[model samples]
Target: MTSRHHNLQHLKNQAYQDPLTGLPNRRSLGDYLQTALDRLHRHAGQAVVMFCDLNRFKEMNDTYGHTVGDRLLVAITKRLQAALRPDDVLVRFAGDEFVVVLEQCGSRQQALAMAHRLKKQVGSTLHVDTAVLQPRISIGIAMTSDPLTAAADLLHQADLAMYRAKRQKGDSVEIYDPVLDD
Candidate 1:
């Protein structure tokens, strides 16, 4: 490839990737969701957005140094990637918060099953330099077959659902409902 083409590709990757975890960033998520929405308009499939937040992450960071926190984040990212399918998109949305886009998911049940698997994977114990940490995560899932749905709106629904899950016991999963939006 030409040097100019290589440079452009590198810049594009840096723009869309999270520097810390090496996962896709929010911008990449937006682009992927837009493409998925367009495909759904012509196809018959469901998309699910899963918003995940680590429980007591701040405390973990406070107790352990920032280096340890960073290590934990990288570890969690690897586990998440391992648990997901090749077509699934996982992005590090923000500190201790990640989003997974399940493209062409068959149904709500299938999405929930995916969420449970992620939660189980994250709940596993981690050994960070003799500090055995058991991390818990709360997940909110929003699935839609609606072609008109905007990516931001879908993400908002998932975010709201995630808050609801966090309000309950940690490591819980909640599906988006219209009532939750109210």
Candidate 2:
């Protein structure tokens, strides 16, 4: 490739990727969701959107410095990536929140299983330098096969589900239901 082409590609990557976690940023998530919606519209395939929030993240940040918090975030990112399939897309939404897009997810059960796997992986103890920290996450899942569903709607549903999970006793996962919409 030409030097100019390479530079442009690098710039595009930087624009879409989170600097700390190296996961896709929100902008990239929006674009990818649009494509996923279009594909679902065409093929009537199932896709799942998962919203994850770290529990007690602010407390962790307050106890440790941002430097340590940043390292913890990176560690969590690696675990998330490892838990997902190659085709699944993980986006660093903001701060301690992440969005995972699972394309061609066969069913809600499959998505829920994936969420459990991620929650288990993230809930493990993390060691940074001499400090050991236990991380917990609440996950919300929204599965869609409808062509008419909007990306924002899906995200909102997932967000609400995540909040519901957070309210529970431990690191939990909740699937979005019609009741959540109301």
Candidate 3:
């Protein structure tokens, strides 16, 4: 590719990717989710958003330091990427938090199943330097077949469900229910 084209691609990656984990950042998530929602409107498929937050992540950072915490986050990102399908979108939403968008998911049950797999994969023990860590994540999932649903609404619902899961003890997955909003 031309150097100018390469520079443009580089700029795009910097804009969209998390520096520590190389996962897509929140800006990319917004674009990808909106596109998925639009496609769902035209077709007969569902899209799922999973909000995942690391449990007791602050404790880890306080105890181990940010460098170690950064390493752990990068390791966790790799595990999560491995567990997801090739087409799934994984975004590093913020510190100790990530979002996964599954497009063309068949049903809520399928989304739930995917969430379970993610929880298991991330919960596995790992060694970063001398510190041994067993990471746990609370996952909240929201699935929609409705084309009229706004991407932000879906993300908000999933985030709400994730908070509910975190309250129940870490490392669990909860599906967003409409009742949860009330």
What's the lDDT for candidate 3? 0.92
TM-score of each model, paired residue for residue:
0.94, 0.92, 0.94
- Poorest stretch of ten by lDDT in candidate 3: 36-45
Each prediction's Cα lDDT score?
A: 0.91, 0.88, 0.92
RMSD of each: 1.5, 1.7, 1.5
Worst 10 residues of 1 by lDDT: 32-41
Error of 2 at 16 (Å): 1.0
- Name the regions of candidate 2 deviating beyond 4 angstroms: 1-4, 42-44
Clashes of each: 0, 0, 0
Residue pairs that clash (backbone atoms under 3 angstroms), model 2:
none
Question: What is the C-alpha lDDT profile of model 2 across 45-114, one tens digit per residue?
Answer: 6878999999888998888889889999999999999999998899999999999998778777788889
Highest lDDT model number: 3
Deviation from native of the Cα of residue 153 in model 2, angstroms: 0.8
**C-alpha RMSD (angstroms) for model 2:** 1.7
Local error of candidate 2 at residue 55 (angstroms): 0.8
- Reference-based lDDT, residue 162, model 3: 97
- Write one digit per residue (lDDT tens) for candidate 3, span 1-182: 69999999999999999999998899888898998888886788798899999999999999999999999999999999999999899999999999999988998778888998998999888999889999999999998998788999999999999999999987899999899989
Q: Following a full C-alpha superposition, what root-mean-square deviation does model 1 have from the true structure?
A: 1.5
Q: Regarding TM-score, does 1 or 2 come out ahead? A: 1
